[model samples]
Target: MGALFFVKHKPTCREIDIVKLTIYTDYSLRVLLYLASKPDATATITEITEYYNISRNHLVKVVHNLGIHEFIITSRGKNGGIRLARPAEDILLSDVVRKTEPDMDLLECFNPKTDNCVISPTCRLKSMLYEGRSAFMAVLEKNTLADAAGPITQAKSGEAVYVNISRLKR
Candidate 1:
């Protein structure tokens, strides 16, 4: 009854399918897309946090992970902050999703030692899950950060923020 967003039906014990993205994944995608749209804007953490009005605390880990994955480069100096390692077109959404959702194993029964799956030896779940993940990425691969930023580029609902794609239309 005290849950923040999720509310259990209490009558049905349906396995709560976690088909949603995590904040870590969410922020990574948002930040990367935002940065990619900025076009030569090497924005700082403070500036980004302010633009999106997101918590700097949560974004810290996301930014750090992005740097480690080589999707983005970070530096400290007067002209240093964070910037894309490669061009926006070169960086695929699938790549970002893959790096961000590293632990997206659908089932744990595939493990050898503590295999919870009773049919571990012949279970097809692992293969199926792999296919599903692949298919998901296949869809995402078709679009780039520039594509996902469709509505974001149009109609000013508030103050001017960095990377407003709406303003870039020719």
Candidate 2:
């Protein structure tokens, strides 16, 4: 008998990373946090930019979108600035995320219009991912800007103290 050989095919599907918020959402949250930290005062874009050490141009767009969504109120000219349109306690994190994120689809199969997966119709993975995403949103829905905008902590150098995730593994 002739020798027979078989080859196993590697999956062509890309390995998608865990769900993440967009930079716009991050900036929006940061702006809101900065504003919430100073409840009695209005903040200029320049001030916010300087405080976070982020891009002014990007912050401008974020501020505009926040204003359009009625999350924040903005005024122009001297003595004019931005302030929260509503109390931080009333602004749910999930609402901000939904409004700012252009797309929330975790996988291609999540969107039927663009889904081209051959196994999508019978895929349990899609349903599992949907459940995971729902759980993620549910957690966010339970929290508000007030819960996230706790006291600001800074280093001795007056810089934001960022957690080192790798160190936490120990």
Candidate 3:
């Protein structure tokens, strides 16, 4: 009698093609972009909510997280508002994505401690996914908040005129 064992197989590109950021991360980037455009002034959640037409409650949480991560500075009181903690040029897009994203694991096999897949031990898919993720992050690491914010125009009143966030190309 012989014992049977399972063989590991490499995943196809299509099998490991799922890569999507959470809405929270998207909102976090939006907040950063908005603040980057208004570098000289602070902005309130209400203003951002109105501009993006998103839920104020969701933005409040995003703002709090951004503050906690030191991505933005928050002030309290009558004149309170939020602004970038540092210059937009100094803030890396990769850092924001890492800070805002709760989980970056591309698949169940990426985390060894929690991974229970039979093929995880021998699978090449995890390595391929790791390479893909690394390439994606490398692109972000090369860019800063200022790069994503694009150009900031000024109105006749000297106020910063920003691109319409809602109408931005996805």
Candidate 4:
């Protein structure tokens, strides 16, 4: 009789799938972090671009989207700059991630209109991916912008706090 040994195989590249955050989302988060880090001062796109060494064209789009979403306020003309619409503690990480992420689909089956998977009708993978995505988002929900950006200074009694008035649109 001959002894048998077990053999293990590593997953091939074809078997592995990778997901990455878009540059838009990356820039959005970086902008948010920069603004949050300087709650008392406004930041300009040029300043942010220089600080991060990112492209002005791309940062402009990110800043515009942030303003449109009410995540950040923008002021034009002299002394014009950007600032967070709300306090860092008031911004939810999950909300930011959801708003910034271009797509949440983890697999082909996740989107019915574009799903071409043969197992679409009876795929356990979809359920597993949903579970995973939910778990991932749940973690973000537990945290706030302040958690990543650090605590904001508390205003003392009879002290004024900096507020971005441009973000007060109804």
Candidate 5:
């Protein structure tokens, strides 16, 4: 038999990070997409909660945070509802993610103040983790919310409808 050599393939940053988004972040994105799908129309908190079948209380916080970030415009009155503050194409996926994800630390050693890892002082792992996170964000930087929202199909009745929200989670 000929000599065989094994090759080691390192996992990508996305693979290494594999960070689970918080429910808050999930809701925030959902709300943004919902508004994006209906760019000309405003959606109320109740409408979004009903469409997604999520808790109103939780969505309230998400909506509030989105408004604070100026991602959406909220009016309070008879016509009160939320709409995108800017065009969908103007909203960068990276910006939403960075604002929503409170911590981007891939490992315990990533944060100097909170890191208790003894190996952190001389650890190459920290650098690797940072590289992974950077790689992950780099992908997000290339796309905007419009790329994610895609085309919203209008039904025969002229009502806007968007299917496959699962794609937006990415």
Candidate 6:
């Protein structure tokens, strides 16, 4: 074989410092971050869904949670939709992630003793993941919605503010 190389099917991951939270976590943040970038700005759920090309079904959950978590306010009117509840700078990135993440457990092993995997009783993996998690949260804590978002000025026609993995980079 010439220049043969076997690549392990490792899952591709985002290069951002924070560990992948979840699609729930991911979309929730995107909703807020998008609106935060447009503080004093608002968009309909349909608008956001169309701009992101994400299923409205999926975004509805995120938008609902944002409403429940007090991260955003929704208005029912032909001229209104959703807007950031507070100034973007006031919302901490860590806070949003904390509220959005399903569970804090970094690994399954953290749960009650199960699966006699030789090192289960003495493995430092759990603690290590914890430490890493803390560090990750601390990094995100340093940035606020404002930092994650761009300044909100005037909403221009044909102007889209939603951000995507491809639009932004690590």
In model 6, what lDDT does residue 45 have? 93
How far off is residue 154 in model 2, in Å? 20
Off by over 4 Å in 5: 1-18, 152-170
Q: Which stretches of candidate 2 lie over 4 Å from their true place?
A: 1-13, 151-170
C-alpha root-mean-square deviation, each candidate: 7.7, 11.6, 9.7, 11.9, 9.3, 8.8
Question: Per-residue CA lDDT of candidate 5, range 22-113, in tens?
Answer: 66677888888888878888899999998889999999888888999999988999989999999989998889888987777666566667
Q: Give the CA lDDT, 0 to 100, for residue 50 in model 3.
A: 95
- TM-score winner, 3 or 6: 3
Query: Who wins the TM-score comparison?
Result: 3
Q: What TM-score would you give candidate 5 relative to the actual structure?
A: 0.79
Q: List where candidate 4 sits over 4 angstroms from the true fold.
A: 1-16, 151-170
The parts of candidate 1 lying over 4 Å away from their true place are 1-16, 110-114, 119-130, 151-170
Model 1, 119-170: lDDT tens digits are 6568665677558756766877897766665433333686434445523535
lDDT of 3 by residue, 1-170 (tens): 01111112322333554367767888898898889878889999999999889899999999999999999999988999999999999999889888977767777676667677877778787898789888888888998988787766789999767653435555
In angstroms, how far off is 146's CA in candidate 2? 0.4
> lDDT tens string, model 2, 1-170?
11111112212235556456667788888898788777668999999898779999999999999999999999988899999999888999889888988877777777778788888878788788778878888888998887777634699999755332211232
Which is the winner by TM-score between candidate 4 and candidate 5? Answer: 5
Provide the lDDT at 170 for model 6: 37
- Per-residue lDDT over 78-170 for candidate 6, one digit per residue giving the tens place of the 0 to 100 score: 787999888878999888878877666545454454333456568766677668768877877898877676543444786655442324543
Clashing pairs in 2: none
User: Global lDDT of each model?
Assistant: 0.67, 0.76, 0.79, 0.72, 0.75, 0.67
Q: Considering lDDT, where higher is better, how would the candidates rank from best to worst? A: 3, 2, 5, 4, 6, 1
- Candidate 5, pairs of clashing residues: none
Residue pairs that clash (backbone atoms under 3 angstroms), model 3: none
What residue runs in model 6 are displaced by over 4 Å at the alpha carbon? Answer: 1-19, 113-118, 151-170
